[model samples]
Target: MAKVSNILFVHGAWANSSAWEKVLPLIGAAGLTGTAVSLSLTSLADDVATVKRAIALIDGPLLLVGHSYGGSVITEAGSDPKVAGLVYVAAFAPDVGESAGSLGAGGPPTRLLEVVRPDEHHFFKLTREGVDEVFAQDLTATERAMIFATQNPLAGAALGGEVTAPAWKEKPSWYLLASEDHTIHPELQKKMAARIGATTVTVEASHVAMLSQPDAVAKLIVQAAA
Candidate 1:
């Protein structure tokens, strides 16, 4: 196995780098260095660029770990030569010509979809109720509140942006499925994981599994790094 000394964490929509606060130390405890990128969430292209820039800063083999929309970012950025592997934590792994929106097109609309509200600029954010009831149900009341307050709204158009290529097509990948996720359906997660031929492990948690089950999520990241 390649020696992966660094891991870059890409957060999903409605979140910032703080989303990985609890998981970073755990990853470090496993003898690996981890950094979470705070995406602009302005556009898919921009997000991918942000990840690529982060990759350029690291010197050795690195693992890319993405959650939710961050998965889409890694799928696009993982093609870089420095990336050693990918870890998808309840995220979308879209292929070439597919956008995050298109991947979930036929699936039943989730409560999250119904609760998202767009600003005048077309950026989307989840309602507080959506955060508490759907997105992070497994988290505590205070934690959910903090998540709702600190969410970084994502541009609505980003969801429809298509990927030019998916890194998972060429790299070793692992997926940690949140079985109780209400945002991204579990079936969709299973399908994406299988499609990518990712080694998968399912956790009985909600959409924000990294926050709710950091240990389990970190464990898989360490395994991928190893």
Candidate 2:
């Protein structure tokens, strides 16, 4: 049987599968099948399970892609035997016993805290300014507005869910470092990428690099798929 050429995507906090809209077509045009999973954003376990379920549906080897907190999801879920590789786009790649929240303690701080507001529940929502200035600064006004309006509240406690085993430890990985990212901090991206020993590519974009530089993002994903 021919290889399925599957590429599965997992989005980050405050984002849904739609966030990969710009790049999915590019992957399709490259003769690859790309599917983005909609995560619950309720907790890491739920998100990881969502990714694993998606992985189970594919019959061949697949590349697992993640952005932002979605990186954490793929790092945990990418351990499946079917996962061939991992691509991280301006995302967090935590190690064993490190949660996304704990890994950043005393490291370079990000502007994410600037606009993050907590709800009555444990969820966190970014303000309009956060979307416009910190998260998707390189996007157009309409794009920024759409992101601000549609963002899902991320369960704050999800950041604290530690990883028992990091898939990056075994999987070949690629990392796209967004230089102008205020949300995750470029310095931290470099550190995580280095720690995971990923094939690193730097792009002059914001936290949402996939939106601002879809060509570059797609190129890296295609490379990882290869």
Candidate 3:
């Protein structure tokens, strides 16, 4: 068995390390530490570098976990020798020369992107409607509000950052499919998981499955670590 030392989490657009707040404690309860990387949401390279920096601080083999755009981050950064496995939570998994933007286009049309509003600075933010109706429709009112308030708008360029070498090509992986996800389609999740040859678990969750189903999310990460 691979000796996984720790679990590292990467958050997607409009989210921070706090996005994994609900699941981190669960991981600790199982006697393993989990680190969440707060991406700058600047671009793919910047986000991947952020994950690499987090990986540098951790010791031993790591289970890299990602959600949404964070999936793209781990796919690139997981190529690191220290990484042992990957766990995708309602995440994107792009291949060489592919970007999350391009992959999403090839998937079914979704309402989440329709509600995204771009600013003069080129950062893309989700509208209130996006959060309440599509992005996290299954979450509680408070949870949805918190997500909307704490969103870290992603740079437009972040969507186009292409992967050079997808780590999933070399690492074992697990995928958590959010059946009720509105941000990334469930079919797309399956497609990516199949492409990466990931062990997949499906849950009736919104895009934010870690928050909505922390127990399930934590279990999958722990399984990967094991």
Please list the Cα RMSD from the true structure of every candidate, rounded to 1 decimal place: 0.8, 1.7, 0.8
The lDDT of model 1 is: 0.92
Clash pairs detected, candidate 1 = none
* lDDT (Cα, tens digit) per residue for candidate 2, span 130-198: 998989999999999999999999997788888888999998999999999998889999999999999
Q: What is the C-alpha lDDT of each candidate?
A: 0.92, 0.91, 0.92
Quote the positional error of residue 185 for candidate 2 in Å. Answer: 0.8
Q: Identify the runs in model 1 with alpha carbons over 4 angstroms from their true place.
A: none
lDDT of candidate 2 vs native? 0.91
Give the lowest summed-lDDT range of ten residues in model 3.
1-10
Provide the lowest-lDDT 10-residue window in model 2: 1-10
A best-first ranking of the candidates according to their lDDT comes to 1, 3, 2
Distance (Å) between predicted and true CA of 145, model 1? 0.6
Task: Please write out the lDDT profile of model 3 over residues 66-156, one tens digit for every residue.
Answer: 9999999999999999999999999999999999999999999889778999999999999999999888888899989999999999998
